[model samples]
Target chain A: MIASLALLAIGLALVVVGPRLAGARWTRQAPWLAILTWQALTVAAVAAVVLAGVTLLIPITAVADDLGAILHACAVSIATAYAAPEFLPGRLLGTVLAGVVPVWLLVCAARVLIGGWRARRALHRSLDLVAEPGADSGGLVVLEAAAPAAFCVPGRTSHIVVSRGALNRLSRRELDGVLAHEAAHLNGRHNLAVALSEILLRAFPRVPLFAVAAVQTRELIELLADDAALEAVDRVSLASAIVSLAEMRAPAAALAMAQGGAALRVTRLLAPEPPMTAWRHRLGAVAALAIVAAPLFLAGYPALSAALSDLCNI
Target chain B: MRPFGELEAAIMKELWSRGEPATVRDVLASLSTSRTLAYTTVMTVMDNLHRKGQLDREMSGRAWLYRPVRSRAEHAAALLQNVLDEAGDRQEVLMHFVADLDSASVAQLRSAVEAARRQGDSAPGDAG
Candidate 1:
């Protein structure tokens, strides 16, 4: 029990501190909330792990004897992971974990970073391919590719890149609709939204829910972009653009275009919004919160105490 | 980014579960497990979400077909991001998120960035 408490404490501390370091660059909409959720969920997850590990590692009676030792190590790692560095001694476990966990987190960050980089590069290529600098061709830049497609690459250096195929496949009005949709991505920073899902994947590998979040977020991003496009273009044109894009060849990640056969995207394109997505996101938020929170506190009292202390003390 | 009230949320939930646009009856049918929702209430909420730029409404023969303007995943991602940011407690959580990332991803991000750099002579902020 004591050992579990110690682990719980350590886990709680990570939840409190991890986001500040890792989720800082989330760079999407609701920057703070996203990081905090990740932090809360991640910490809760780690606590569950520790709680389970301790349960398996130490017998009930034997937990007391190891409490001090576990607490010390926990303190060491938490301090190393977050403290001023001068505060804690560089112990072996601390060093190992300090090195390992961040590297683990980099897994998610790496995707965004790489994708962002490739996107940046691809943006340049697209720009060069089109020779349009803020040409305002309705915020759509025709790329040199042959397949009709669209996607929104988010970031400060973001763009709604399109290909010749997409332009050719889609009528001028449909292309205009596609451009409007892509513009919405940049304006809404859907890329950042997808990035959050990516981070969730890294943090929660065991839970397939993260993938669900990814899928849902991708669809929502499209919807939000579609809404934005609707502002600048005609609904029918936008709908047709989505339908045609759905029927066109798939494009790269940054380019959110209508693929030839994205059934769901096609369905959404054919239909418009009502109460479905909003509530689904809400439920996801609730479920995600519960799943994330339950694990952290799975140790019952130990996890509860740890969380209370961390929040109160903070 | 705020919670869209439990009622509106419930209505949206119904639509999302069906994976398509729905009417008041459709929303109501899926929500039968919950409290009773007025037909007008569902109508109003979907109309509200539609106005909020969250839902898309299309005219049908006599009524409007309601669909999600955004997918559940997209909204959750956005909400998760918001949840991450709620307290501005950047003092710790950020580190935890970053620290948890495995090295392979870190290297990948760096490699991608490096590749991007190589692909274009543009400065860090100006990729154009």
Candidate 2:
């Protein structure tokens, strides 16, 4: 149990800090996006290779099972209490997760509800910008503000909002660029990216590397949006608009691809790789998968096999 | 508009008639002598086209050369797609346009789709 806890701790620590120390070098490359993707691949590859390699060498299958069963048993008791909340659940966390599952879960459930309410309230409040009615493939929701920008608030139903100042300033051509950029954000599920980054960062705050990785991921999301807009419109127009809007683009607020600054995006737009012809895109996807698998292989078979077995429990 | 009114369409048209990445000077030179154009005005027009996402540009010393990123066929297809997407449930309008497709063109489209399906089928993981 001590060893397992140590391993988990170390893993979490690496997850948090490793990105900051090393991720910066990659984001500086010519096509920051290509490098961003490469870093993501690197993270997955490292994780997989480490897990598979450790699993191959160490056989902790039995102990892991015992630990998992204990955890599961605890979970079941907690779930039961929640299912039947009449059980006088005294301070849940202080008592329930104190090896008394039911009370803990009630506490957790309460916490989650409160957190969700707060989050919803914050989201409703943040959307201070008015929505402009746009007629496009998916109706566009524009926020007319002086903040030269674009961003998609991600969820079950995504909202693409842009600033009013952006609309007023941009020519129709430039407006197309901004609209397409925002569309790319929606299509890419960048809100998830932001959420994932935040979760990863919060989970492993010590690892400066994780923060670096998150920042890189954020920038890459913008680049990806720029790439999509290029296809919908002309690269030059996108690039020009990005340059023009750099002054007006907002910083990342929640889910949107905060309008990018001029220098990097413009460079990429002016000289994109012919939209990565289909074959090349396929190659990239394949490479990403391979990298994703490497760390899983390293995590060691015993834990993996145990995980597979546990899947039956689900 | 001038080109449409008088350009003798034969082996070439649009950007091709002038050749790829033609400059304002190049296009003006080709234009029949009617109006004198200053460099900045022509530059601005090309710039506008570029900004409109109609033209792609490349750096050439102090100036930039521009090209049409999409071919004429692609532009037409995109316009058609855009119209279809915009026309909310305009079945009659859509059917009228579909009827306008020449028999040979329709045949070509059918063959193209068949070929695409065949190719897709042949590709790994394409089958359910």
Candidate 3:
């Protein structure tokens, strides 16, 4: 019981402080690593909170002796939660948190997934009717809009849509930069990452950490995509393409090339980062590993102990 | 990739080519040149298009007359608009294919493009 409480407290503290500490400037230098750290933190935080509630509900005596006692207690409490609807208020809250939190989060994520899928299906169908297949050999569709816009519809039949205004406005080099950037987005499957962050944010809107994670992840993916495009185009061309497309919007269902973190991207591009020495990159890797492992170890401790004790007959 | 399926695109093309409001019979007749299509199929497609806000219809005696709400170009433009405006919270940080810049940033972009153009003109081989 004491160990569970300690783990729960540590988990809650990490959730509150992790985002603040991780949002440092160095994250920009190593976005991929930062993203991994954030994802790990989110999973650990949520799991810890739920486990805390579960541990509280299970009588201490159940886990006081060994792992077998904890499991037996957990099973009993879950059954009791369902059978005894009229329990005391404290017990009721514990029962609700332990049983309902996971289900609620799942429902929230499903709603976002299903909603995005339906909207994308409908919008893509409409896009097919109106857009002209562009002259470019690449699978680019042309829209006749005056506003300079370019975006990609990702999935099995991914297509990049560019407006006539954009086609006419962008120089050949700028257009190449934009196309490469959008391709990076599709190839990276960045939408899935954004959607996962969105699910977490939707499930817990009040939690600033989730909101921060969603926004930061969205920005990081854009940065990562830009990094991928750098191999193909000059920094100025990519930055200009992004800057020019700043005003054009696309449907939420499609990942827009110029979406999220434009200012930061432009700054990073135009004033390129001073290359990190080998030691700094190595240090970053170590930090990322530490952040990722901390939560998993803390959250998994109780479960591991229970299994080990039960097997060893201790 | 074609946004619409074969029949939907064919139906749209038929309606777009005809300047006036078309009935199911008119559209089907035009499309039957290369392949045969049932009148009911054309009617259902038109109805589906109407529901999807791609077309508008008027009552003409016993039958309904259908016409595209906008020209093909305008429809294409509107599709872009739909992509822009449909995502409710999208305005803040959603699908921005183009940058939603303030005037200052727009000026900055214009200048940058101008500079790039000048550089391209002066040193043609610089843009590798």
Best by TM-score: 3
**fnat, candidate 1?**
0.00
For all predicted structures, in order, the TM-scores are 0.43, 0.43, 0.78
Q: Write the per-residue lDDT of candidate 2 for residues B1-128, one digit (tens) a residue.
A: 11111221211234654557876677666553655656676666667667767678888987677787655544433433333233212211111101122233334333443454465468746421
- In candidate 1 chain A, where is summed lDDT lowest over 10 consecutive residues? A252-261
Docking class of 3: acceptable
Which residues of candidate 3, in runs, are more than 4 Å off? A21-23, A57-94, A247-260, A275-286, A289-292, A306-311, B1-10, B17-22, B29-38, B44-65, B86-94, B108-128
Candidate 1 C-alpha lDDT tens digits along B28-114: 777766677677877787788889887888888887888988766565444333422331112111110011123333333334434
lDDT of 1 at A83: 26
What are the per-residue Cα lDDT tens digits for candidate 3 across A1-314?
Answer: 44346556766786789779445877777777677767867776777667655655654333334556656655444433323223467466566656788889899888887777755665567667777888876777888888667887775666788889888978798889888888888888777877877888899899988888887887787788788888999877888787666634233223533333677787787666766567987787787567656645654565555555533343
Candidate 1 falls in which docking quality class? Answer: incorrect
lDDT string for model 1 (A73-169, tens) is: 4444333322222223423334444455556667767765575555345434324332233346444444444534354444455555555555566
DockQ of 3: 0.32
**Candidate 1 DockQ score?**
0.01
Task: Report the TM-score measured on chain A for model 1.
Answer: 0.54
Off by over 4 Å in 2: A1-132, A135-137, A142-148, A248-261, A273-292, A302-314, B1-128
